[model samples]
Target chain A: MAVSVLPQMKQAPEMNPVERLMAATAADMARVNDLILDRARSHVDMVPELARYLIDSGGKRLRPMLTVAAAILFGRGQGHAVNFAAAVEFMHNATLLHDDVVDESDMRRGKPAARMVWGNKASILVGDFLLGQAFMMMVETGDIEALGVLSAASAVMAEGEVFQLAKTGDLETSAADYAEVIRAKTAVLFEAACAVGAMSGGADAAGRKALALYGLELGNAFQLVDDALDYGGQSGTLGKNVGDDLREGKMTLPVILALEAASDSERAIIASALGKPDATDLEVHQVVAIFNRYDTLRRTLDKARDHAKAAIAALDSLPDSEMKTILADVVQHSVSRAS
Target chain B: MAVSVLPQMKQAPEMNPVERLMAATAADMARVNDLILDRARSHVDMVPELARYLIDSGGKRLRPMLTVAAAILFGRGQGHAVNFAAAVEFMHNATLLHDDVVDESDMRRGKPAARMVWGNKASILVGDFLLGQAFMMMVETGDIEALGVLSAASAVMAEGEVFQLAKTGDLETSAADYAEVIRAKTAVLFEAACAVGAMSGGADAAGRKALALYGLELGNAFQLVDDALDYGGQSGTLGKNVGDDLREGKMTLPVILALEAASDSERAIIASALGKPDATDLEVHQVVAIFNRYDTLRRTLDKARDHAKAAIAALDSLPDSEMKTILADVVQHSVSRAS
Candidate 1:
C-alpha cells in the first residue's frame, strides 16, 4: 500500500514529478481546496458529509493540480483559475462517486466506497449534488467559453460511461472503441481543466489549444498506464485486485491485445473470466499466463509510452518555465508507473 | 380516470387553466419542446433512450410552460425564453429521474419508471447527463445573471432533497421543517424558472419580484396538493398508488399534520407503515383512515389554498394581460386538482 503510483519517481533524487507540480501550485491548490470544501457545505448535513468523504479521501487532487499548474505556467491567473480548478476536481470526484455506484465497487482509495457506506441512492444523488456545485463554480468564473468546455466534457463523460456499459464484456469491442471510451470519459475532463486554466491566465487561443492538447495526451497516457497497472500491479498496489478490469469486463488495451493473439483454448479461458463478477483466481492466472505469453502488458505499456511522448510533444509551443519541466516529467511518470 | 387536475375549472366549460396557459404560449412552448428534444440527442444510445423515456412520458410540461408563460407576460425575451424554458424542463426531468431511483418507485406517469426499465445506474448517469445539458443550454443563452439563479436553485434543490432524505420517517419532523423541505425541494426551481424567464424577458425589477413570488407560492401550493392527493386520491390518480409517500416514508405536509394529531394507537400504526417499503395496501388504508379521523388531508388542502391565494395576490403588481390572468388561474388550479 505504501508503494506510490510512480515508485520509480519517488526513488529519484529530485522531488517526484507529482510532488514538484503540487509544490509549484501549492498555494493556488490550497485555495482551490478551500473553495471546494466551502462550496461542499450545505444546510443538509448529508450533502456535505458524503461529498467531503470523497473530496477528503486522498485522491491526489491531480486534475485540479493540473488546472492550477497550467494556470501558473501561463502566468498569474486573474484568480478565477482557483474556482475552475475546484470545479474540475468536483467534476472528477462526482464522476468517481457515480462510477463506483455503476461498477458497484466496494472500495475506493483504500477505503469503503461511498456507495458501500451511504448506499447507491445516496452516492448517486450526492454525485448529482457535486456536479451542480461544479457548474456553480464554473459560472462564478464568468467565462462562458470555459463553461462550454467543461459542460461539453461533462456530457461526453456520461456518454463514455454509457458506451462502456454497452461494451462491457464484449470481446468484439475494438481497440478504437476503447480509445473513444477513454478519450471521452477521462481525457475530456483533463483537456477542459488545462484549457480553462490557460484561459484564466489570459492565454491566447493558440496557448489554450496547446494546453488542452497537452492535457488530453497526458490523460491518455495516465489511463493507459492505469489499465496496464490493473493487470500487472500487486494487490492493493492500485487499491484494487490485479485483473480487476478483466473481472469487470473492461476492454483495456492489454486485454484487447491479448484477446487478439489468444488461441482458441486460451480465448475460451479469457472469455469465461471476462465480465464474470465471480471470476476466480485460477481463471485470472490462466488469463495472465496468456497475457505474459503474448507480452500484452508490455504492449500496453508501449502504447502508454507513445501517449506520454505525444503529451510532451504537445507542450513544445509553451514558453520555458520550471512548471513546464515538471509537466513533462509528469507525463513521463504517467507511463512509468505502469512499467 | 377522466378527472382533470383542476376539476372545478373544467366545469366552467372554458379551457382549463393548464390548457389555457399552454394555448397562450403554444408557439413558444413548441419551440422549447423542440429545443429540449434536440438537446436530448446523443451518440450514446442509452443517454437519449432513458432521457427521452421520461421526457416523452405523459406529464404536462408544466414547469417549461410556466417559464414560457412568464416570459411572454413581460414580452422581451428575444427568443431566449425558449432556451430557459427548455432548461427548466430538463432540470425538472433530471430530478424526477434521480428521485425515482432514490425512492425506488416502480412507476411514473402511468408507466414503469425509467429506473425500473433501465436499472438504477443508468437512471443516475442519464440524469446527470440531462443536468449537464441543462447547464449547457442555460450558458448558451449568454445570460450570466440567469445562469446564477438556476445554478443556485440547482444546489438548493439538491440540499432540499438531502434534507428530505435525512428526515424521512423521523415522525417528529416539525411543520416548519416540512415547509423548508418542500420549499427547497420543489418551490426553488419554480421561483428560479419564473425569475430567470422574467430576467430574459427584460421584466422590470418590480415585475420580476412579483413573478418570482407568484411562482414560489404556486410551487408551494402545487406540492401541498400533491402530498394530500397521495393519500386522498384513488390509485393511478397521480401516476402512482395512494399512500406511496407513506410507504416511502416521505414526511409530506399531510402526514406531518396527521402525526401531530394522531392518537397513540394511530401513531403506532402510522409508524409501522412509515418507511416500511413492503407495507401492504391494507396498511395504507388503515393510515388513511387515521388521516381522515384527523382531517389532515383537508388541512393540507386548506394550506394549499392559502398559498394559492397568496400566489394570486403576489401577481397583483403585474399589468393586466391574458397571460397574467392565466398565471393566476394556474395557481388556483394547482390546488384545485386535489379537490
Candidate 2:
C-alpha cells in the first residue's frame, strides 16, 4: 500500500543536498556555533541579547557552512576556520539586520524581524555592534592578508547596497546593472568568506581563487533564485509574501528581465505596482502574470542554473574529495531548492 | 568700545587652542585631508556623496588633529600616520552618524544631520561603509598590533553606546557607571586614536602607552566639558539648546552629582524632566536651578579641568618638542574653553 510515501522517501539513505552537507560538516558546524555563541557575549546586556536573538533564529547558516567546508576541504593550519566561520556568520547576520531596516521588513526567517521587535535604531546600532565584533574576531587571527580580503568585501557590500538603493524602482535598471548589484551585495561576501577561509586553512593561491569563484557563483545563483521567488514561488518560502522585493523598490533580476521585454501597456502595468509600499496581493498577482507572459521567472531559474553549473565547474581543477563533491552539490542545490 | 577691546584681543598672537594645533600640523593635516577626500570617493554614488556631506561640514576635526599631532611628535616612518589620521576621522564620523541615528539628533555642526537629510537608513548604511573603509585603511598599513588597538576600541565604543542606552533616564545610574560609559564611548576611541598614531610614527612601547594615557585623559576632559556645556555653555556651543542631556535622559556627570545631593523635591523635579522627550524649556530651567544650587556645573567643569591637567602631565616623559608642547596646551584648552 502507498504507506506514507513522503515519510519513507525522507528516511531514504540519500538525504536532501543541504542536509547532507549539514551532516558531513556537522561537527565543524557545531564548533562554529559554539564560537558564535561565545563571541556574542558582552558586558552590555542589549548587545548580546539582540545579537543572539537574530543569530539563534532559524537561519540555515549557509555562509558559515561554506566557510567551514572550504576550510576543511583544504585541511591545513591552526584551525582558524572556526573563528573565520563565526566572523562570516556575524557579517551575514549584521547585513540582515541592516537590510530589514532598509527594506522596512516585518519578518525574517519566518519570525518577527529584529527591527520589528527592537526598533530601527536598535537594529542599526546592533548591526554596527556585530560588525565591530566581526572585525575584532578577524583581527584576533593576526592574519593580515585574510583580513584584507574580508574588509574589502565589507566595503564592496556596502557600496552594493547603496548602488541598489540608487537603482531601486528606476525601471531603467539593466541586466548588467542588476548583475553588479547582486555580485557586490551577495556574491562578494561569499567569495571573500570562502577565500579567507581557505587562506586560513593554508590553501594555495590557485585553490583559494577556485573556492572564491565557486562561492561567488553559488551566491549569485542563490540570490537570483531569491529574486525570482518573490515573483513566483511557494507563499511562505521567503519569510515575507511574494513580490516583497518589488514592494520594497528593489530592482531584482526577474523584474529587470520582464521590464526589458514588456510592451508599453505591459510596462505601465508593472511600473504602476513597482515600489508602491501599499502594493496589494492583487497587484502582485498581476505582476506575476506579466512575468509569466515573459517567462521571466523560468528564465531567472535558468540563469540561476547556469551560475550553479559554473560554481560546480570551478572545482574541476582541484583534486576530487568527498567534501569537494558536497560543496559542488551544495552550490547546485542552493538553486534547485528554490524551485 | 573706547579701545575696541574685542578686536584688539582677537588680533593678539595667541590662536584658539584647536587652531594653534591645526596650524602647527598644517602640512600633515593637509595630507590627512587629501587622503580622507580621496579614499572617500566611491563607485556607489550615495557613499561618496553622503560621506562628503558630513566630512565637509565644519567639524573641528579634533580627532584627526590629535592623531596627526601624535604622529608628528615622534617624527618618523614615511608617514603611515596620514592613513591612520584619516582612519581616525572616519571612525569618529562613523560614530557620529550612528550616534545621530541613536540620538535622533536633527543638527550637527549647524547643518542638518545626515540622518535628517538622507534618512536613518542611509545614515546607518553609510556609517557602515565608512567603518569598513576605516578598517581597510588600517589593514593596509599591515600593522596587526595597531589594528588590534582600533578594533578593540570599536567594540568598546559600541558597548558603551548600548550601556548608555540601557541607562537612559534610569535614576539609579551612578557616578562610576557614568564614568565607565563615557570612558568606553568617548575616551576609548581617543585612546586608540593616539596610540595607533604613535605606533605608526615608530614610537617605542613606553611612548605609545604615554600617548594613549594622554589621549584618554584628554578625551575624558573633552567629553566632560561637552556634558557640562550641555547644562551651562553659551548659545550654539552644542549645536542644540542647553540641558539637552537632561531632555534625553542622559545621566551625565552633573545630573549624577545632583541626584546624589538632591533633596526629595529637587530629585522629583529632575525625575519628572529627565528622559522626557517632550520636556519643556521651563522644565529644563528648573533642573538647571537645582544644578546651580549644588554647583554641579562648576563641579563638572572642575572635573574636566582636572582630567585635562592629567592629560598634559602624561606627556611629561616625552622629550620637549614644539608639537609636544602644543599637544599639552591642546589638552588644557579642551577644558578651559568650556569654562
Interface root-mean-square deviation, each candidate: 1.1, 1.0
Candidate 2 stretches with Cα past 4 Å from truth are: A1-12, B1-12
Model 1 spans with C-alpha error above 4 angstroms: A1-13, B1-13
Question: What is the TM-score of model 2 when looking only at chain B?
Answer: 0.95
Error of 2 at A205 (Å): 1.3
Best by DockQ: 2
Q: Summarize candidate 2's per-residue lDDT along A1-43 as a digit string, tens digits.
A: 1123112223335777788667766778888899889888888
lDDT of 2 by residue, B212-260 (tens): 9999999999899989888874647667668778888999999999999
Give the alpha carbon lDDT tens digit for every residue of A39-97 in model 1: 99988888889999999988899899898878877775586899999999989998998
Task: Give the TM-score (vs. native) of candidate 2.
Answer: 0.95
